[model samples]
Target: MNISYKFFSSHVCRICHRSINWEPKSPVSIASASRLYSGSPSPKNSKSEDNRSKEKWWSISNEWKIITTIGIGIASWFVNAKQDRIHSRKQMKMNLVSSQLKELYGPLYGNRIVAETSYRAAMKEYGGLRNYLEQARKERDAEMIKRWRSYVWTVLYPLDEEAVDIICKHAHLIAEKDFPEEFDTFLKHIARMRFVMEQWKNEKGNLESTKEFTEDDFLEDTNSSGIGGSKSMINHLQLKCKHLRKQQQEYVEDISVDNLTLGMLNKIKI
Candidate 1:
């Protein structure tokens, strides 16, 4: 008896609606088919594999983490140190300005006020300083001369001397970068008055011998172009004080801001 067989490469099942291969397969063909199916990965499997690859790529070693941490710490320390130096320098500047205002300009300004008040009073009583001295010299009235000498010795000389002493001691604190021209005139005025006073004392209140000493030389020049002008030393000092106070306030605000920033940084570090 002879048998005949018909073979189909693939056929669809009626009930399950699945395709089945009816061809015979060798081991090599079966393995190749299996590999082909696995190589074309599904969406779910691709995503999971990608996640694992990303985890490995982004992983940090322990040694690298420690090194990075130390680098950040050093950078933070340097920044804080620089800020501290800037703050300290500003504080020192503020202190110097305070000293200038308190030790030098403050006392000088006060003395000037008192001296001006006393001078106005003297002028009211004796019809101005230069005029009174000239009248006293011309008239040579013993009582008038004595009173004038007493006023000069008691009030004017002492005030001038005190001003000179203040300048001598605290000249470093003067706001001007250069020595003031007004200061030279003031010193000269004091020196001339001192010489005249000495001569008057030696001569026993005699006005005849000291005739060479003129009013311009022996008296204080109230109008020496800059003394009582709009741009006087007192005005300069007042302006300087105002500027310094503003600067000091700015320094304080900056320091406060720096402190606040440092505090926030410390919190972040913690």
Candidate 2:
């Protein structure tokens, strides 16, 4: 019997009752197997990874945008609040200055001007205050003395009294922190003059007893003190009024500029 043995690629183990197969693999099939088991991603995985990357980018961008917007808003609020506080403070200061000017300095300055003008006119009429007083006293001129008394009673005394009243009532509105030396001197001068005038009135305008407190007494007091008889207080009042007016103007301009700037800022914010 001529029997041919055929080579088999597969065999079965009879004892285990299992088949064993030996197959040769091609390069294409090996590469495909490697791709399946390796770290390389599939099409579905690639699409999902791309979506995740896009989501991360968008999240980071949005977060920064939100943070920037919040920062700008907070900064703007702080700026506006600071400006408002400053404006309020300036407004209060301006009001106080206005009150001082209107109620105190303005009236004081005006009164001083009128008093000075009246004094100048009187001096021109009599050649000089001292000259008139001396001539009236030496000549015992009752009419001249009476004229002097009338001018004092009607003009000088009244004006000085009114100024004192204003000073007493509006002391708080004075620009200086302490009472001014010129003002104190003026008060003393006015008091002395009032005392002399009252004594004359009590004596029934007796020109004889007027020698006791002559015009020289009060006139010399005022000249020495540089208050009523001189230009000291007038200059002081004029300077104070000018300074206050300038300050008021400055405050007004500053407030106007602040308002304009704040309006522009509001528009920009809107």
Q: Across residues 1-270, which tens digit of lDDT does each residue of candidate 1 receive?
A: 122222222222332343353455587667667767888665567899999987776675655787888888887777777877887887788788788778877777677667767777877867766676566657654455456566767886698789789889999987778987766667776776666666554345544334444444333342111233213655665666678778768878887887887775555331
RMSD of each: 8.9, 7.8
Q: Which candidate number would show the highest lDDT if scored against the true structure? A: 2
The 10-residue segment with the lowest total lDDT in model 1: 1-10
Q: Write the per-residue lDDT of candidate 2 for residues 171-231, one digit (tens) a residue.
A: 8998898898778877888777766665445456643334454555334332222235347
Question: In model 2, where is the ten-residue run with the lowest total lDDT?
Answer: 1-10
lDDT of each: 0.65, 0.74
The number of the candidate with the highest TM-score is 2
TM-score of each: 0.62, 0.72
Model 2 clash count equals: 0
Report the Cα lDDT for candidate 1: 0.65
